[model samples]
Every structure is written in C-alpha cells, then in structure tokens.
Target: LACAFMVMSGYCELTSVSSFDAGSFSSKIVTLESIQIFTTHEWLPAKPTLYFLCQGGNRTGLPDVKKVDFLYTFNGDESWQPLTELPERKCKRCGLYEEDQIKSDDVFDEWELCPGDFVDGKYVHFKEKEFNATFACPLCKPLEEGSPSSASKNEATAHGMNVALVIVISALVSIVVISGAAVGYKYWQKKKREQEQARFLKLFEDGDDIEDELSLGNTL
Candidate 1:
C-alpha cells in the first residue's frame, strides 16, 4: 500500500497504487487529510528492527517478499534518502534488548514473542531445536514462561526447609542440655545428703563415749 503522511505528525494518508512500468510509478490523486499519528513501540534488538505484515493466503502460495528494506527521509530534507536492510537472526529470542528505562504512556501494550513479528499476529516465528516466539501483553510479561515465578517458588521452598531444620535441631539441643543439667543437679544433691548423714553419725559416736564416762564417775 502507498501512503503519504505529514512530516510533523506520524499519520499516514491512504493512497492507491496502479500498474506501471518499473521506472514510472502511478499514484491515485487524493487530497491530503490530517489524521492522528499511530506510533507503536516495539522491542527490537540492540540495533533498530523493521516490522512487516504478510499479505498472502495460507499454505498454497507463499508471499514473494524475499527481504524487507526500510526507507527513511528526514522531516524537511528530501535529499538524503536512507535505505537499510533488515538483519536476520537464528532465533528471535536471541539479541533482545531489555527495556528498563522509563515506561511507555500506553497502559495496554502488546508484546511480540519474536523480534521482527508484529503484535496481534498469528504467524509467530519458531525454531526447530531452539526456543520459539510467544507473544504476551505488557501485563503478562512478568508471568510468562521462564520468569521469576518458578525461581521464587523454589527459593521459598528452600527457605522453609531451612527454617524447619533449624527449629528441629534447636529443640534437640535444648532437650539434651536440660537433661544433662538435671542429672548433674541430682548427683550433687545426693552427695550433699550423704555428707550430712556421715556428720550426724560421727557426732553420735563422740557423745556416746562422754555419756559412759559420766556414769562411771557418778558410781565412784
């Protein structure tokens, strides 16, 4: 589709293309109308990535789009027309640039699983032995596959096991210490009782000799 847009705003005006020679191009004469810009933020590689939608039907005839080239012209200067070729990767999951800076203004943003695929499209890219592309909304990115949820669960389980083991070991150590203290205290108390009985027996024997001597003196 041929479209024209005002350089100031990002809106594109719809234009029709007719058959013509290779050098000569035909365009429908339509008045320019001002429209709102439709700018979207896509997660590309560290380098800039281009996006395109397929315009072919299913399984029968594949689209003849061999490669995509992005053409850019500056706001006022039409002299410099830059063309860039799209770079292909083994998998879209590789070389993804993570967005950590300021967030976008839109509350609901679509996330494509692959790098080059557009949002809300069904023809997701896949690899034979490598990871495949999966699309997710902005809200769903946090809970997507290989996220922190599984790791967090594993950490929690490990923490709980450690806590339980610590509690059990503490209880066993306290029981052993308290039992040893009780046995030592009982032994000390038994030795004290035996020493007191021995002292009483010694005093009784000494007093019996004095009583016998006083009886003999009274008889004399």
Candidate 2:
C-alpha cells in the first residue's frame, strides 16, 4: 500500500536588545544596535523555545546575573520572580533593600552563562556544567567523542555525507571530460589527414598537363 504524508510549518522569533520599554502598562519596544529584525523559524513538529540570549549585565533590578540569574522574563506574568531572584542573591545588606530600590547598573564584569543545551529543555538555562542535577534534557546526553548535541550530531553527519557525494560526482565528471577531449583530438587529426590525401589525389586526376605547362614556362 502507498502511504502519503503532509507537512506544515510554523515560525517564531526572539531578539536580544540593549533595552526594552513598557509604557502605559501594555505596549513594549525592544531597542538594539541597528539590526531591523532577526528571525528564526519554529517547525510544527519541533517547536523551538525562544530564549532571550541575555548576557552582558542585568539592567533590571535582578541579582547579579553572574551569581544566579540567566533567563529572565521582564514584563509578563513571570515578572515578579525575575525581579525578586536578583535581590535574593545579593549580599545581606544588599538583599535587605527592596527590589525597586536596587540600582539598574551594570556590575560584575565576569558573569558567565552555564553551559546548557537548548533543545527539549534538557538542561536548565544558566545551570552549571558540573551541577548536581539529573540530565533531564533529550538533547543533553553525554556523547562519546565527536557528536556535540543529539540533534546537532545528526545534522553534521548528513551534511558530511552530502559533501562526500558531491566530491565523488565531480571527480567522475572530470574523468569523463578528459576522456572526451582525448577522443575528439584523435578524430580531428584523422579528418585532417583524409582531407590532405583527397587534395593530393585531385592534383594527379586533373592530369600532369597543367604541371608540365608550368614547368615549360619556367624553363623558357
């Protein structure tokens, strides 16, 4: 029996900007350095989660991002948790201040994002590499040597096979072209020899009278 399948596509994009402003309690605008819009497609079967990819330093009144915070939701329902977590990770005197009282300045130059696998939420964002947690993400399995991510390794393998196939096909084409050129050169030489022989025979078929007349004139 013949089976058929249908495919559908969906897309979503998230951009990291230098700043975001929410005015009148609703509309928001993200400001960045001159990139109009960056887009990524989300497949129907695999809905890729949109991460903010926020690094640098926290402009929001959150804990020093280097110390604790990583993925932060600024305006929506996860707003309070994002703001509170920052202050909690501060020094005792620093923690006592209310979240609103905290200054929104860049601090701690060496904040580092924990190595994380993005697909399937296997590793929590900003979770330490040597963390004391179970490997829950489908994409975060320990590969032996070459494979990077579960999905990334498969992609790399497929691309490598494609490149190998192209090289093989190109080599075959080059061989065929060189062989064709050699055969063509032999055919051209044979045709030139045949034309010369035909011309020589025509001179004799026209008789030696024309040749004799030319010789007699030269002698006179």
Candidate 3:
C-alpha cells in the first residue's frame, strides 16, 4: 500500500546542488505555475490552506488554493502571483506548508532552493506523502566566473582605443596647420627681400643719371 501510494503520488528524491553543472547562480523570480496534492495529510473534513515559507518563517500565502487531488493552474493574471525572489549565489531554505488549527503548520517538503534547480525554466518538486508542484523561473541563469569583469575589461579597452584615435587625429591636424604656417611665412620673406632689392637698384640708377647730367653741364 505504501509503495502503491508513493507511485501514485509521483514521489521525487531530493536533489543536491553538486548534481548540477558548476557555475555561479543568478537571482530569478519564481512563480508557482501549477500544483496537485495527492494527499492533504489532514483528517476528514479538513480545510487545508496552502502557503510558502522561506528565509526563516517568512510566509507567503496562496489564498485561492484550497482543494486536493485537483490540478490547479494559474493564468497570466493577478491570480498568478510571484512566489519569491531567489538571491544570486545563495540557496534559500524554503518549503510549502499547510496551515493547521490544532498545531503548528504541516510541512509538505523542505529543500534548499537554488537557481540551478530549474532546468529549461521549470522545476518539479514532488514528495510521496505531500504534493507535486511545478515552478517556473524563465530568467534564471548560471553565469560563468569572471563574466562581469570580462565585460568591464572590454568596455575599458574600447574607451582607450577611442582616446588613442582622438589623440592621433589631433596630432595630424596640428602637423598640417604648422606646416601650412611655415610655408606662408617663407613666401612672405621671399617677397619682402625681392621688393628691397628692387628699391636699392632704383636708388643707384637715379644717382648715375644725376652724375651724367652734372658732367654735361660742366662741359657746356
């Protein structure tokens, strides 16, 4: 009877983090997509209320769920609420529980919830005596070591290349401007020298003409 119950209840063994590939985990938003309870672990005429507990008794209730052995599906609406936010690089001690009027809450199952547990954006947690559940975290991902630092290094290298290109362009522009200024100055000096030589020759020719005129006057 126990074996038959375990089989019918979809029993799942506890999985460890070491079973997954080695990588750093990232934060993700978890959603309780669907759940079905095979046994409520309650007596007759029991009013079972489901809630999630994590981070040392922080409770979040699913007020709408009350039935057992019926698959409850959540639509993409207000009824489909986010369960919890898992931290990056840390596994949360979490579990599902039922509220009890006579005593402490009844635990369905307790496990260390890690981002790596989700395969292809979903994870199924099942306990033989309690319940079977499906959780969704579409954005959960495992990051390799040095990934963020590698991105920062790439950005820094690109910035350095941009600065070096700007410096080279500025140096080229300065060289062109200085060469043009030097050429213009040399041209102006050549023109001034030519003008001065022409003026001196004109002065010498005027003196020669005056001397020739004085000589003719003396002869006459």
Candidate 4:
C-alpha cells in the first residue's frame, strides 16, 4: 500500500511492503522521502521505548498529521502530540534523552547518538541528562518520565538563575556606559575652555599693539 504521511517538519510518501506467511505476516517500509523520523515513544510512561522507528500495521505510535484535504491522528487522538524525544537506555532509564523535531531553520543542531554522526553547533545538542524520576505522580515511569511538579520547579529555578545573571550583567554594562559618557563630556568641555582662553589672550595682545602704535603716532 502507498500513502502520503504528513510529519511534523514536512510531508512524505510512505510505502509499505507486506510479506505473508501461514503463521506470521510482516510489513516493511519500502520507501520514505527522508532517511530519518523522530518519535517520542521512548518517554511514554511504562511502555517499552520505540524511538523514531514507525512500526506496526496501524502505525500505532505516530502523531496527528494534517494535509489540505484530510487530517490524520496517531492512535485516534484528535491531536497528535509528540512526547519529548528520548534515547533508549539500558532498561534502567537512567540516560533518557529528548530531542526536538528538526526544523528547516535549525539545520546545524545535532545530538549524535551514534558514533561517526558529525553534527555541528547549529543542530540542537542534547545537554547532560537532567535527572528524572517518579516521585508523587503515579503516572510517571519507573525512572524519570513526564514533566512532574518537581521537574517544573527545577526548570523554574534554572530560569530564575538565568534571569538574575542577565540583570546583573545589564546593570554592570549600564554603569560602564554612563561612566564613559561622563568622561568624554568632561574632556570636551576642558578642551573648549582652553581654546576660548587662547583666543581671548590673542585679542588682548592685538589691542595692546594697536594702543602702542597710536601712542607713538601722537608723540611724533
């Protein structure tokens, strides 16, 4: 079967190849426009991690995709929601990761899960795993899953730190700018005063010469 799939970033034509047997039947994706797909199946509460790979006949873990004429939702939800992207851990869920779907504008962002994947700084590089664990919430996985209240607090604290740092730096910068402007203004005033004094002295000397000439003329 051949169909078009609208993913988060764009649209692609997806073809499925099915092989039938007496006991088992399997379907394989024969063609897709892009080499990779992103999925949030890993971070789902208790389910086993099915990251990025779209499997099953129903395409069960996929999200809602909309085209001009039709709309499709994964798992029958009115809207498709991609969970935060996470990598498959060794079942301990210690080092789960979340990656955003790549945007055309964000080409350079990268999280190199495999060796030899050379992603530059423009690609989003996943930071060190922010520790997640189930606390008060029963819906949370055995390890860290979902944005719990505690996680929210942690994010808020980090944000607060960032804001305070920016404020302090801004204040320091304002002080430096004001001080420099004052120094420049004072220097300009001093130079102007010196120039006026020199002009006055020249005028006074010229007047003295004129008086001397007049006195000499009178004496003659």
In model 3, the Cα lDDT at residue 52 comes to 86
| Residue-wise C-alpha lDDT for candidate 3, range 54-82, written one tens digit per residue | 87545778877788788887752445367
Q: Which lDDT tens digits does candidate 1 get at residues 1-220?
A: 3333353233322221222332121211111111111222334433322222212311111112112232221221122111111122111112212122356322112223322232332223333322232322211112233445545556867999999999999999999999999999999999999999999999999899899999999999
Q: lDDT tens string, model 2, 120-193?
A: 42333122331121113222223334434435657878899999999999999999999999999999999999
Candidate number with greatest TM-score = 3
Lowest summed lDDT across 10 adjacent residues in model 2 is found at 84-93
Please report, in order, the local distance difference test score of every candidate based on alpha carbons.
Answer: 0.36, 0.35, 0.78, 0.36
Candidate that would win on lDDT: 3
Put down candidate 4 lDDT per residue, 1-220, tens digits, no spaces. 1322345223322222222341122211111111122322233243222212221212212222211123222321223222222222211111222333442111112222211111221112232222111111111223243435336546867999999999999999999999999999999999999999999999999999999999999999
TM-score of each: 0.33, 0.29, 0.50, 0.33
- Using lDDT, rank the candidates from best to worst: 3, 1, 4, 2
For the record, the alpha-carbon RMSD of candidate 3 to the native fold, in angstroms, is: 22.0
Candidate 1 positional error at 83, Å: 52
Candidate 1: where is the Cα deviation over 4 Å?
Answer: 1-147
State in Å the error of residue 57, model 1.
Answer: 42
lDDT of 1: 0.36
Residue 178, candidate 2: C-alpha displacement in angstroms: 2.4
